[model samples]
Target: MARFNHNKHHSSTTKLVFLISCAGLLGAALIADFLWASSSSAAPAYLSIASSWALEKSGILVVQNVTHNIAHHKREDVKDRKERIPERFLPATFADLPAPELQWEEMPSAPVPRLDGAAIQIKNLLYVFAGYGTLDYVHSHVDIYNFTSNTWGGRFDMPKEMGHSHLGVVTDGRYIYVVSGQYGPQCRGPTARTFVLDTETKKWRSMLPLPAPRYAPATQLWRGRLHVMGGSKENRHTPGLEHWSIAVKDGKALEKQWRTETPIPRGGPHRACVVVNDQLFVIGGQEGDFMAKPGSPIFKCSRRLEVVYADVYMLDDEKKWKVLPPMPKPNSHIECAWVIVNNSIIITGGTTEKHPVNKRMILVGEVFKFHLDSLTWSVIGKLPFRVKTTLAGFWDGWLYFTSGQRDRGPDNPQPRKVIGDMWRTKLRL
Candidate 1:
């Protein structure tokens, strides 16, 4: 140690104070940086394929920015970041797709970006109807894509906006029928009324209301009539099991009816239904509400792989629900990717929630092929990205999909997003 003089001691004290202050400032800045980075990572953005088409062997498509959740990120302070964080799935990838087999085409620019609706192919035209868009309900806006001209040109106004997340839609060669949708930001509730549009007249009309008023149900054309099944009538904490049917004639309403065909032995959440060979089958959903119910929840995050259906039911044999062989994968939000390929029901890209015992939402595998006749499921292939199983459908041998609420186990009710990324899985079968 060295001795210090009074004058020297005073000078040293001043220098030490200055150094301490500088260190404090630098520490504060580092903490601020950490907080900012954590918040930025949580912000969610809208992702969609503006237009998807096949290239020589790979799939090429233009992706667009639709909507995001920057506001939700600002609510948390530095400490709150640990408990609650937003999700940003950016810098998307398409490398998961098989190379030298399927590809996508580049689009110029989209006039408007939308998602969570139905696309009906009429003659050479593709008509899009009510769906949850980047904004509120995507109503009063009808878009027509002409395959012959290889361009998009027609637009019509809808009477009212019914922002349904996963409702059923079907075209009867003359009119397009949209029925049973949910209306709200969350897309969890149910809508009562049905909307119809005449392709030739370009006019819209209303039809008889559904008895129970369900949304996100699966529907298809069978025997010149429309069949609807599954979907939820209550919140995510509650589950509903019901089926409905409607008959149409000459672009006009003929009859409307609802029936409780078969109550699922053990009702599940987010049930998926599809039709093949004049027979409709219901598959994969949660067994009970994990958040409110007093039991282990089945699904956590939506898994990309599908396996082990709880119960498989067929709508035939005296209209009684018959139990077919169970699906290889049990899934929820699955009906949309299902299509009839060569008289067989080809299903794809649905998610399974991990049993709620863990309480987390994750992305799983893609499964397809539930033979209605033989009562079995086979894997076709998987999707490059994880999607809500409910946001897919079959149109003209191509599988089309939209954005929806993906089950993120119990950690978060992750919004799969009401995106406009329209993907078409062009198949040879």
Candidate 2:
């Protein structure tokens, strides 16, 4: 054991001596290098250059472009980084925001002039139904205009030829549903007709009848349900105070049941009620008749003050109704086209407030837009022609303005030359 311990000590001594020897050799080599460098410092600088030139002649060393190399590297680094986007590609400034572009085109005329009717498009076909027709008479005929062929081909006559029948008609791409409307020229009490037409078979059937017959009410399809609201209770044009809805399971599978949604707080008559982006918006209509009542022949522009509504009401997330910002102008005698162009809810053309002294009415042909993001309304543009009491629908970024009664200058009630003129406006993209 003692011998083994001595051998281990001897091995350690050997390793230590070898390390010291290696360090001494490295120090000697470094000293020699220093001496050589010191000697070369005294040599002519041109000798080093001459050696480089000789190497280049022999092609052993190559000359580099130092300036060009540095610049190229810097350029590559900048190239790899992102470039600032061009002005044309940059985010839109206030001045660069899109301006409204509207154009109107006349198409083939309807066989009969329609007022206070509904226009719904199924596929490429447009169906125009019940309204006061020729001679201010009420009639029932489903006029079908096909845009695909650019012609009026087929027709469906209503079972009972009654006019002013329904305030609105809605479709779920397959079936067109017509609800209660006025009966005759007098625009008397509403009818109980819940007419459903099948576009596929070109046949009509009755769904469950409207609980109470009423006309001029705003009706639309919301979340697969038929939503009806804010229309005349009396054929004399009293706006109803309540709103209602019935579930339509699919496009055509409507449950024969009605459910109360919410009572409108104000302005039921002549308001445009529409569902855009799942939000319900009702805008601009007559609030109350000024010094007017039943059994009176001159039911307009009385000595008493009138109330035209500029208020806007909206239905919300919790199945409740509330007021959004009011419209800027007071407009009554509603019946104009409300169209949704992408994110903008556009209301165009309506009868305006009556003059205070002259009692002459104003007709509005201006267009207003409600932007969903900003939650505000602004005037985008005006219609090319002053028109009102029109039926409108949007398809493929185009707004189809159907037959509507035009505004006559300074007349008490615009004389009924309800037009059969068809015009189309499309946003230029």
Candidate 3:
């Protein structure tokens, strides 16, 4: 054999430079092949074949490159939600879940018509607490529905004069904790009227008052604590994002020292909030962070701020509020109702904004179900009727909601009926 060109005079550095150049050329070829295969309409087998032959020694590295490419493609797909068909990928309720045998059942009506009430189920009993009545009157009517009997039980009025509608109420089976709500003749409050009812004893007693008066707010119990979130403090216009919490022993409160946690990014006059898997979900809410340039009359005079949000937010265990995917459009459903069941969060009813400036305004009857794991939303179905300002709760296996309002509106010019009928949808989720 001809004498090998083994040049002892060539330093190690020269060898390194030559090796690097060879490696770079190989890398450039691999990249070009990858791009050509990806961009071209026809699939080419040359890249894999060449890579396998040339980079055989660095097979592990080649595998890593493939993995990285896959990960990058997945990230791109995730960013574009429109590319996802949630129904094909996610279950309406639970993952890998079979189709639900769902049915709707009509139940006994409330003795009187009411609206803006809070609904909660303690064991087998569904309680419809204080709400606004006909003639724009505040109601203390407390109605109980027995799922076992499929009938309405004896009606009970509130112990004291119940406040205006949109009060937050949560129960730990034994006690019903009613938080701040509105009252007064002008429908003007955001009152600190806090009351607790011994469900077993049927006795209502005053408990720790709310830190501030809030109206049209939402509350949920997470890990033996009550999380109160979002509502107007002064008026419906002054939406609040502040959140407060207090610990409880079993169902009863253990101590009274309530602490405020990380507030929500935006606040709205009407927002629905709930806790699932230690995450707080706020939906169909709005945020009015507008200010009138410091000293303008709009600022000094406290002019109404108009803002509506179709975005949804979740507060996690780290106390961080994360913005989830927004509604299909930007119209804020002014009075929507939401409930968490199985593997999804479903929001229903509520009309869109009417103002011209809020162009997304559209009366919504579509029910959207958000699959928790996939982080995707699907229009599972629509409401039978356009329902707004309705209270929703989960009892047994049914989602109890409103029927048709017999006209809960103006009785003079047009008789807007109040939907006093109780309807429950049984789900085998």
Best by TM-score: 2
lDDT of each candidate versus the true structure: 0.54, 0.64, 0.61
Lowest-sum lDDT 10-residue window in model 2: 86-95
* Sequence-dependent TM-score of model 3: 0.64
Winner on lDDT between 2 and 3 is 2
lDDT of model 1 at position 6: 75
* Candidate 1 lDDT over residue span 317-353, tens digit each: 4667777776554565554555566666765555454
- Residue-level lDDT of model 3, residues 162-204, one tens digit each, is 5656678877777888888766322444677677777787777
TM-score for predicted model 1 compared with the true structure:
0.60
Q: Which ten residues in a row have the lowest lDDT in candidate 3?
A: 87-96
- Native RMSD of candidate 1 (Å): 12.4
Task: Give the per-residue lDDT digits (tens) of candidate 2, residues 1-429.
Answer: 999999999999999999999999999988975565456432322244565565556544323323322321122245433442211111111011233556677878887787667777666777788777743376677788776665776877876734354456777778777777766653345576677777888777767777777666777888878887777665434557877888885444456578887778873566777677788787888754323345655332234344567787888889877878877576654544776666877776666655432444455666677777777877776565556666665666666666767765422233346787777777532
Q: State TM-scores per candidate.
A: 0.60, 0.67, 0.64
Question: Per TM-score, what order, best first?
Answer: 2, 3, 1
